[model samples]
Target: MGDKPIKQYRKSRPRAEELYSRALESLAGGVGHDLRRGHPLPLYISRAAGSRKWDEDGREYIDYGMGNAALLLGHAPPEVCRAMGDALELGFHFGNDHPMQLEWAELIQKLVPCAERMRFVNSGSEGSMLALRVARAFTGKTRVLRFEGHFSGWHDGVGKGAMIPFDKPVSAGIPPAVLDTIEVIPADLDSVAEVLEKDRDIAAVMLEPSGASWGTGPLTVAFNEGLRDLTRNHGVLLVYDEVITGFRYAPGGYQEYAGITPDLSFHGKIVAGGMPGGVLAGRADIMEVFDYTGDAHRDRYERVHHLGTFNANPVSTAAGIATLKRVATGLPHERANRLARQLRQGMDSILREEGVAGYAYGDVSIFHVYLEAFPGSGASDRERLVTRDVNVLKGIPAPVVSAFQKMLLARGIDLVSYTGGVTSSAHTDEDIALTLDAFGDVIRALVRERVIATLK
Candidate 1:
């Protein structure tokens, strides 16, 4: 609610800014990922605990971004930290299998019924890449289908259309041949079916159950169920990319919520316990393609490789196991869901009271606030809400939206500037109230500025 606008964020977080400058000399875009860049230069974090992050300049803010939806249990929860500490005492990596990996895999299998067999990887991209490889190998097909907006990961094969223009390719170095193998389909079932029918070479259909790329757009349960049946009948593997939704949605993930089981699933985020880990799990028969102990594989074990040096490293495995165990018994999801509902309700109520031409909607722990030219009463109306016309929300002509983000940032609220916010388990009732208050103040300010007119 400060009337003063944030013209620029300080570059005084010298360490991060300096590191970014140095990185630009060797790294592309001065950052590891393009999404890391935000207005006023991304603040360099010094440390984080629970629901808050302290930047290098000592500014503390309530973090709803949660490491891009990775920290479900919040940052460095005591149990996960303790487990990682114990594992570190035993050493970080090993030449072969470890008890921690098995323990984590077992826990995943127990919780996710579709995961009859599981393999850990270093990150979600790796997990997704390996899953595609396995699917292609198992099904003898070359093409993979994915929705236009959802992001699978950063691997060349699955990275297309992520942050791309109108869900087109955003990166430059990728070869056209590599992009062709990926079939981008609309979320509509008929469109998917049409593509499947036309392209018989598709090995699998990979999708995020929640439609997360557009900020927690919940897919209809029937749509998911229909896709499951379609893929099964067509002999195409159904891969649920649960990287963001896995533990955050529920203990069983979106698969459980939709009451549909995919042939293969990828997991990251919550599964990693804020470290770095990923998992691919599915039917034992389909996953057997990864096994190397068969008669024809005695010598091929070394040749037929699907391995990473840091895959299932002891520390990450321990952290994952501990985090899952804790989440299984706690109220993290319930707390997050309650907070999400509270935030959405408060935003909606404010919009109505202020006669703002916009609305907010989403699932339990995640939601999106769309500042549209007109209000959407339901899903049918949502289709008419185009991103192009939402200039007031985007604030392209001036730094209105960007300035609003900085205002919120200055007020100690951490939200993904490009997208809507997320709710974490560490968020408290007071935190929810404060966020709603901040949101109301911003909306009122926008109204005063004539950026958004009264609904009436």
Candidate 2:
């Protein structure tokens, strides 16, 4: 153990605790999403600005969660909020087509490499579901090949391998037959080939281009391009579920960064300017499967139907239009990525200096912090991490993560979970320094408390 005494870090946020207690009476676990459920209590955010937010007890925090990576410009960006407000005055849903949607779609087509055709959906979840349906209809295939631990959405089919143990459904409602239609495997070319060869009826191969769990499990650019080529040669449609990477990785997103175009892609999160909406964009010919006036050979079951009551609605489209216009120059992504690089570098320096067991790793603008140190393993430790069946592999113990998160909150920093965090254009260099400083303290505390170790 270290010479220092363990610091009992705790924030005075009793109001948050009370609210969570009250919420538990009405809401399940006092939270909406499963991820928000906490060990002690959930944080009740009062207000948020560019890079900071206040909890119920008026505790200000430097927020790294950034709306779960949906806020590239940061929370309540005035420009986006003004646009949304104006659109709200106009109305949300219209029985007929609106002009603002044209601006939104046109901006997307102008930037995204695979936006030859596009359709609006209510959320990233809807976007993923529609992408699969279109692929099935266009290819007449009955199954999908997905990478293990890649999250498409919370839907029954593509949601299987994301966070739950491998091959286990995310929820209880999905049937066995629904899961049997999709195949999950480790992220490798041989596995891809084996799955394709074994299952001729596979409709599409889908993945998060940035890698599973937002690059906690990183993927190589060569492998991404190889998948495109492999799928095309095998007549299997390739789909990039870029719900997290869209508008964050680059101006044109991951497809532009990798220069490997897929047949389809799903976009959400930052695309709607911190609002609720998503997109299904890709090859026009294949997307025509959603059209009614298709070829004569197209049968009823072969035609894909997609409809959203709020699809292309004014508020989201207006916010999207404003956000795309502001971000089209690519300055936001560049700034966020620059900040991310700085944060990662600083974090790595601390880990090394402190002789911590784990490392910091990620792609352009995304990063994750792994606490479980595997001694005698170098970067290969990260490579080895991906091969494990995630259902059975618990990376860092949840309790340790939760304690770290609470400590971060006490220190006026908030992240999505124990590991990685999303950077934003609004985050200043000072914010990066503060986060790094807090991380160093937290790591040292964990060491003193016997939660983390200093490798000899």
Identify the runs in model 1 with alpha carbons over 4 angstroms from their true place. 1-8, 11-27, 164-167, 212-216, 293-304, 373-401, 452-456
lDDT of each: 0.76, 0.81
Error of 1 at 383 (Å): 12
For residue 448, model 1's alpha carbon misses the true position, in angstroms, by 2.9
Which pairs in model 2 have colliding backbones?
165-391, 166-391, 368-420
TM per prediction:
0.89, 0.92
Best by the lDDT measure? 2
Candidate 2, residue 287: how far the Cα is off, in Å: 0.8
Clashing pairs in 1: 355-455
